[model samples]
Target: MLMNSNYKVAFFDVDGTLADNELPRELGIYGRIPESAKRALSKLKEAGIEPVIASGRNYEKIADFAELLGVDSVISSNGTYVTFQGEPVANHYLSTELVKEMVEQFQTKQTDFLLETPEEILEYAADELLPENILQFLCHCPKEDLPSLDTEKLIAEKVAPTALNIHYKHVSKASGVEEILQKMGISSDQALAFGDEENDFAMFEKVGFPIAMGNGNDELKAKASYVTDTVKNHGIWKACLELELFEEE
Candidate 1:
């Protein structure tokens, strides 16, 4: 059981933590969020807790799941877009000049990449596909190719050997978390967090109850207050049950 009553909200990482990760080329199936997680959400609300999604995927990628789960706040693209009550609180974008420059680089290098606009992720073939509101870019290439892609405005973080999350500087899930907590009239120590990657570290450092999935990376798990089961095994629900957050009479 959790030892404190201050955990009023929960922040969840979309990939690996909530739903199976299926972006950056969609190499994996777009599986639905586990049913147990849905039930856990209901139970958490009953106990007076709020849930917000924090994911490397952009708003367009996580919206359907957020809608289905009835979540109001979402921190997307690691922190590029943040919303509360389904309204934008933060929308960070890369420089249009920088974005076009990346497109040119990828095309010149003959590598496949995806540009994340507000509405969807698209193959970066030309200027025609670039959206009026750009959010993130994902490049697919060998790890060795990453160094050359880094520029002053855009930086690369490896998601896989072949995929890197390229975004503007100083953006992180913790940045979005701070935005919502401030608007909600609370502090970082008042929330819980769940994640399974290094990208989740910033959020983990900020929240009160940081739970790492069993399948999470070693560094992330080491920092968590508690470690739950893998996402495929109802990780969110299992942690909820273990939390024992029954409302006080």
Candidate 2:
């Protein structure tokens, strides 16, 4: 396989993309990165393509994983915080007023939720023990039981809740990727993105080539430019090989 210089950067979703969608037993611990996936990332680096972890997990949760994978750039917290090459690129936080309103609404409905900040995750009327690896804000609530928010109010306040329950109308994985692209002075057409969930839709829209894992959401697969194998079957390696994103040594 020959390297494809057309892609200068690759954005990778964490859960169900780079790592298996399994619950971890310990806090901040994640499933091992498949050896093949590691090799593929190395090859990308050798081919002069930057591989970045773009996940819904907060920076604190994904930092160790990123370090283990040897990737310095990351888009975390559903695009609320981003760092490129170990340098802060952007941090888009939910407005204080919006947070207060959401908290009140959640309390009124007795919904279990957690508030995520750059520093830590705060429990807000949550009853169950916090999971070792908390991915999103909403917890232990069924889709039907989820509290209804004032859509009009949210729009008027210029704030939107993401699929991951992140409240930031101006922030998303796409927005984070855009920041990195601008910093690298590369066009979106030169970027490749891989994702496996509904939250990843925004990211898929921002990239020239979008790949969906075999075990990914059906809707995501439909939007993907290419669909590869499951993460357990070394999908990252297979996709890079087929796309010629990196040369096999």
Candidate 3:
């Protein structure tokens, strides 16, 4: 059990924690939240904890999963965008000029990629103009074909075996969580988080209770306060029950 049991909010990573995330199918995309996950969220809500999504998915791509799980707040593009109770709170897009320059570099290197924004995804081509709200870039080409640009100013997170989600360096699920908690007058002590990827490590470090899934990254498990079953094995349900996030039957 956690040392603190006064959680007011819950942050969930989408790809593996709350849903079955298999991409190239959902690369920078969200599939669906399983019934077990939905039930967990419902129970968490009954316990008076607000559920929010903290994912690398873009704002438009992460919505259906949020709607399905009956959640309102979403931190998407790895924290480049944020919304609370279905209201927009923040949008931290990558620098347009930098993105364009990177795209040019990709072309010069003959890299094939899919560019994504808060609005849509497009294949990177010299003639095509990037969206004004560009949030991420998914390079389909060889990883080496991608530029070796400094990540101190931006980010390049591997989203799939063949793709990477690019965003600003400061954008991470933890950043959004910190902002949300500050605005809500809540402390990290009042937040519990669950996730299953390298990207989720930051969140695990920030929350009071960090729960890692059985199918999650071993590194993440090493850093977790608690570890649960895999999503397919009812990980969310098990953790909720164990953590007392749900009432006894």
Quote each prediction's TM-score.
0.84, 0.79, 0.87
Kindly provide the TM-score of model 1 when superposed on the true structure, using C-alpha atoms.
Answer: 0.84
- Best of the two (1, 2) by TM-score: 1
TM-score-superior candidate, 2 or 3: 3
* Shift of residue 169 alpha carbon in model 2, Å: 2.4
Write candidate 1's Cα lDDT for 183-229 as tens digits. 88998778999999888888998887899998899999999999999
Q: State the lDDT of candidate 3 residue by residue for 1-249, as single tens digits.
A: 644557889999877787776434543333445677788888888888989888777677678757866888888877888888888788777677888788878777877767777667777656766678777777765567678776678767777787787777877888999988876789898999999989788998788889999999999999998999988788998888888877655
Note the clash tally of each candidate. 0, 0, 0
User: After best superposition, candidate 3 residue 186: deviation in angstroms?
Assistant: 1.1
Error of 2 at 142 (Å): 4.9
Q: Which number leads on lDDT?
A: 3
- Best candidate, TM-score-wise? 3
Q: Could you arrange the candidates by lDDT from highest to lowest?
A: 3, 1, 2
